[model samples]
Target: MLCAYTKLGMMVDARHLFDSMGERNSMSWTTMVAGYANIGDMKAAKEFYDLMNENNAVAWVSMIAGYGKCGEVGTARRVFDEVVVPDASSWAAMESCYAQKDMRQKLLSYIQANEENVDGTDATVWGFFIRCL
Candidate 1:
């Protein structure tokens, strides 16, 4: 329901429903964070992200994307650095952030590093890098 509201751009209603839920899961938190991001509220998203005890890939990606959406490349990079094991989405978000900031060299370095860390290269990562280039 909250996700539905968020998708509909009714962030206030989503927050109301979110607050009413007695049991909250990671998805719920992610939804709210996504909502904040959609509405260009990076501070609220970051705050909500901090409150979460267990952060999944989605949560991390949301924070990174939120920061990127707000033109805070430094914050996005910091979040990217904090990721333990960045999945494709996380890496893509970081790449996109760098691209948006016109830091092509840095984005290329990240792609190379990520490729070295993983046994096999991800096509999505390559695609993201190519798009940036």
Candidate 2:
């Protein structure tokens, strides 16, 4: 229901339903974050993201994409930096954001610097960079 409301752009109802819930799982938290982010409500998304006990890739990617959509690439990078262990989706989201914003040099520099930190053998991670190039 919360997901449905959020998907329909009915955040007010979604929030009401979310707030009334006694227990929230990661999916519930992520749904709110994604919903808020999808609507360009980064403040709300960030608030929910901060409240999440265990940050998942979906929520992290959502925040990055949301900031990118708002033209806050720097902030998106900050969110990306916060990921402890970014998955392929997170890398793809950040790389796509950088590409869309024409930050090629930054993207190359970022990829170069971060590649050493990422699993050098993870093809999915490497694939995003390859596609970016």
Candidate 3:
């Protein structure tokens, strides 16, 4: 219901329902974060994200992607850097941000600096750069 409300852009209703819930799980929290971020409400998204008991890759990537959508590339990078162990999706999100913003040099520099950490199976991230460049 909360996700449905948020998906429909009924944040007010979503919030009302969310507030009334007795026990919230990660899905609930992530829903709100993704909801607010979808609406360009970073402050609210961050508030919800920060309130989460444990941060997950979904939440982290959402923040990075949210900030990226808002043209806050620096903030996105900061969020990406905060990830303890970023997965391919996380790397793709950051790379897409830099690519979309036409920051090719930064993208190259980032790839070079992070290459050592990327395992062989995460070829999608490298493939993304190949297409982007």
Whole-model Cα lDDT of every candidate shown, in order: 0.82, 0.89, 0.86
Please, what are the lDDT tens digits per residue for candidate 1 over residues 1-133? 7889988889889989999999998899989888887787888888888898787888788888878878898889889888888778998888778778888788777667766565356787667767757
Q: What's the true lDDT of residue 55 in model 2?
A: 91
Q: In model 3, how large is the Cα lDDT of residue 102? A: 86
Q: How far is candidate 1 from the true structure (C-alpha RMSD, Å)?
A: 1.9
Residue pairs clashing in model 2 are: none
Please give the clash total of every predicted structure, in order.
0, 0, 0
Of the candidates numbered 1 and 3, which has the greater lDDT value?
Answer: 3
Off by over 4 Å in 1: 113-120, 128-133
Off by over 4 Å in 2: none
- After the best TM-score superposition of candidate 3, give how far the Cα of residue 27 lies from its true spot, in angstroms: 0.7
Worst 10 residues of 1 by lDDT: 113-122
- Please give the ranking of all candidate structures by lDDT, highest first, separated by commas: 2, 3, 1
TM-score of each: 0.87, 0.91, 0.92
Model number with the top lDDT:
2
